[model samples]
Target chain A: MNYNWNWGVLFEEQYLNWLISGFGWTISVALSAWCIAIVIGSLVGVGKTVPNKIVRGICATYVEIFRNVPLLVQMFIWYFAVPEMLPEDWGRWMKRDLPNPEFVTAVVALGLYTASRIAEQVRAGIETVPPGLSAAATAHGLSTAQTYRYVLLPISFRIIVPPLTSEFLTVFKNSSLALTIGLLELTAQSQQIAEYTFQGFEAFTAATVIYVCIALVATILMQVLEKYTRIPGYVGKEA
Target chain B: MTDFDFNVIWSSLPFLWQGLQLSLLLTLLSIIGGIVLGTLLALARLSGIAPLAIVAATYVNLIRSVPLILVIFWFYFLVPLALGRPIGGFYSALIAFVLFEAAYYSEIMRAGIQSVKRGQVHAGQSTGLSYWQIQRYVVLPQAFRNMVPILVTQGIILFQDTSLVFVVSLRDFMTASSIVARTEGRLVEMYLFAALVYFVICFSGSMLVRSLKSRMAT
Candidate 1:
């Protein structure tokens, strides 16, 4: 009951700059990781459905390992453990010569973790597609690759937009974990502001507001994308 | 590369086990607390009262919007200041996890409740049962059964999240591993071992949920 509250400290020049830069890092990390996630996730997802048993097993193992491990642990492994596991010169380069090691390590860790989740979604999306479509594509003399490329992926991607949107939102939120490895994203910046000013409540409130705003905007944008991509008479359309 | 050391892990077994116990304790307590509070929030949202529903919905959405780390920070730093005394890291982290996970648990509970047929409620009504009686004797049993797989899945995620208490310097498993890694200079061995332990527990948990889901479907 005796603590002082100073909301104004958040707007002071130095604090404001920290928040801005922190916000910048958060967005950059999330977006870059998202790009990696979607691309790799889709491929791994498609790999899970391939005819080769070994390929499917490999894909399944990837999803299990990445998805099961905690993101914070994974971050540490990437930042501290993986480098040393590499050959001597490469390990040295990773530890000492890599530019922005913290940032790069964070992006790679977050991306790989999110990729596993997204791969699961993508796999579900593909599996839920009517088997008749694939059968018909083959009946039309389409190669398996052609069938998947031209028929399966487009419909599966549309079917999964809603789940994908939530996962996208999650990546942004999970980007906060970057602070664990020394990347000063929004959450880290807010904590720093709280430390410097002794105004913990105001600092956290500002961070919360910014995060909520980001989620709202992202939700709205994804809704719009969902609307544009709606499949006529699909299950989600009425809902 | 320096020779890998299995001896360090064997030596630190007691410390690691202590940390693992704390992580499981936090996860267990938070899951219980989250489900209890979440069930109430679900009821409030489904209640006919407009303000109650809106407030419940807003709470769920707002909490869902932010990272758990920020909420953990809020409780760790601000709650003590507001209350005029520190509650220490463990309690603050526990409170934060409970509140944060409740938002997610509420949505799951709401879906489970809604999945029950409306006719079931009407059947209870025709039997002259009170609303609370109807919910208690009829709806909730079915809802809980329907939600078991999802609840377990969420519990697994909550277990993973308990490691985030490292931010407050609480000696959970992840933090314990990091501490030993630092002091013993065995970052590679310690962290990889930590990851392997988590993988085994969580991967098996998910496998259990998967079997449960399949059984439900059958």
Candidate 2:
């Protein structure tokens, strides 16, 4: 109860700058990883529904492996273990020559982890599409690939917008874990601020507020996207 | 380019087992605590009292909006400061996980509760049961049954998240692996072993949930 309460240290130039840079890194990491997640996740998701057993099996295995492991452990494996497992020259380059190795590793780790979850969402979204529509597309002389590309994917992606929004928000939150691998993202910067000023409460409170704000803005934007993408006369699972 | 060293992992089994036990303990304690607190929050939100519902909603939303790691840091500082002395890492982590997971569990509980039919409540009321009795004897059993698979899914996530205690230097499974990796100079082997263990446990847990879901559907 007697601890000193100093809020001023948060606005000081160095700490403020740290927070800003940290925010930038968080956005950078989340966005870059999300790009990776959405692209690969959509492919794997669609692949899971393909007729080829081997492709479906590979996609399922990817989801199982990636989703099962913790992101922190995966990050560690990428940051510390994978490099050593690579060829000597490649490993040395990754260790010493690769720029922003921590950031890159964090992105790849988080992206792959998030992808598995997104894949599940995408699969569910696709499955939610009424079976008759896919049949109609096929019955209309559409090739299997064309059926998916034109009919299945468009509808599935729209249906999944809501879940994808949550996943997008999750990417930002999980970006905080990048701190474990020495990426100076928002959480790490706040921890740094706390360390330098001993104002842990103020520092973390700021980080919490920033995170809440990011989540709020992201939610609102995604809601708008959801509204825009709503298929007329279509009732989803909730309905 | 060292050959795969099963010997290092075999020799470190005791230490690793100790860490895995701690991780499981944390997961168990947090799930129990979170579900209990979360049920209260869910009930408060569904209670139809405006202020109570708003307060519960705000708490759940705020907690859900932030990352679990930040909450862990917040309590790691706040608990010691508030108590006038430090509680050790395990207790602090436990407190944080309970509070954070409560928010998630609240949402799941809310869905489960709502999934119980309105007709059942009316049936209980016609039988002269009080509100609490209706909830206790009628709605809750079905809600809990419906929620079992999802609750297990959340527990699996909790188990994976327990590894985040590594930030606090807690010797959870991941942290223990890293320590042995450092000491033995076998980072690749140690980390791969850790990942494999986590995969086995979590994969099996998810598979169980899938089976439970199918059974429930039937």
Candidate 3:
């Protein structure tokens, strides 16, 4: 209440550049991790629903193991423990020679951790598709993969657009955790600004606003996509 | 170096156990606080009052947009200045968790409330119930029942998130483990043990929630 307030310091060149690059890193990490999550999550999700008991069990176990662990702990494992677990030279390479090891580890950690949650959503979306569609596809002589590619996936992806958007936002938010591993992304940059300037309120408030803007834009874009991709006479109409 | 050590964990259990207690305490207090605040937020959003609805929606979206660690830092830094005195890390972290979790809990509660049929409210009103009475007697009971599983799931998330307090140097379970890991040079052992405890607790908690969900379905 008594302290001097200086919001204008954020506009000064030094901190502005830090925040800009920090925002860029946040987006890059989040978007790349999202790509990994969706790819791996869909495969695991399909595996979960497949008739092969062994494959299903493996997928289920993967989801369980990843989902049960905290993302922070998982990041530490990837950054610290996993590198040392490798052979001596490989460990050294990971610890030293790897390009932006913190960034890579963060992407892997956030991606794999989120993939479990995405897998669940993907599984739910796929299962929500009518069974008769798959049955009809098979009757028409289409293979299982073809059925998923043509019939089930098209509909389920449409149905799941809204949830996927939420997950997308989640990935963005979770990117802030990458700071823990020494990636100076948006949240970390904000903290650094606060540390140096003693303007914690201004720094975090700006970061919070940037985060909200990103989430809002993502939400709006996804809503538009959801509107267009919605299956007529189906899910989106009712709810 | 080749051998895994369980002895360090056993030796350090007392210190780690205290941290675990703190984690649980944070989770429990925040659960109660979050649910109460969240219910109000849910009702406010649903109340159709322009200002209240907008405020509730904005609060939920804003909090949900940022990483919770930032919120923890915000409160850690701001609360003391706002109050003209510094507070302890535990209290700061607890306040952050409560406010942050309330945003998520509000969204869940909103969905739960919306899931209750509109006719239920009409029925309550037809029976001479006041507005508050209708909500208390008719809407809330059903919404609470519907939301129990999700609330517990969020509670598990809150437990996991408590680890972020390591940034504030709070001696939560993860912090304690990291401390022991550093001092004792048993990095792998300490971290893995900490992870295992978290995994066991969260895994079992989710299983319980899954069963509760199925039971509700049936």
TM-score to native of every candidate shown? 0.99, 0.98, 0.97
DockQ of each: 0.88, 0.87, 0.70
Which candidate, 1 or 3, would have the higher lDDT against the true structure?
1
**Candidate 2 CAPRI classification by DockQ:** high
User: How are the candidates ranked when ordered by DockQ, highest leading?
Assistant: 1, 2, 3
For model 1, what is the C-alpha lDDT against the true structure?
Answer: 0.94
For model 3, name the residue pairs that clash: none
Question: How well does candidate 2 reproduce the true complex, by DockQ?
Answer: 0.87
For model 1 the local lDDT of residue A228 reads 91
Winning candidate number (DockQ)? 1
Query: How big is the positional error of residue A138 in model 3, measured in Å on the Cα after superposition?
Result: 2.2
| lDDT (tens digit, per residue) of candidate 2 on B1-218 | 55778799999999999999999999999999999999899989999999999999999999998988899889998999999999899999999999999999999999999999999999999999998999789988888899999999999999999999999899999999999999999999999999999999999999999999999899
Kindly list the interface RMSD, in angstroms, of each predicted candidate in the order they appear: 0.9, 0.8, 1.3
Model 2 chain A lowest lDDT segment of ten: A230-239
Off by over 4 Å in 2: A236-238
| Global lDDT scores for all candidate models | 0.94, 0.94, 0.91
Ranking by TM-score: 1, 2, 3
Model 1 residue B190 CA deviation (Å) reads 0.4
Error of 3 at B199 (Å): 0.9
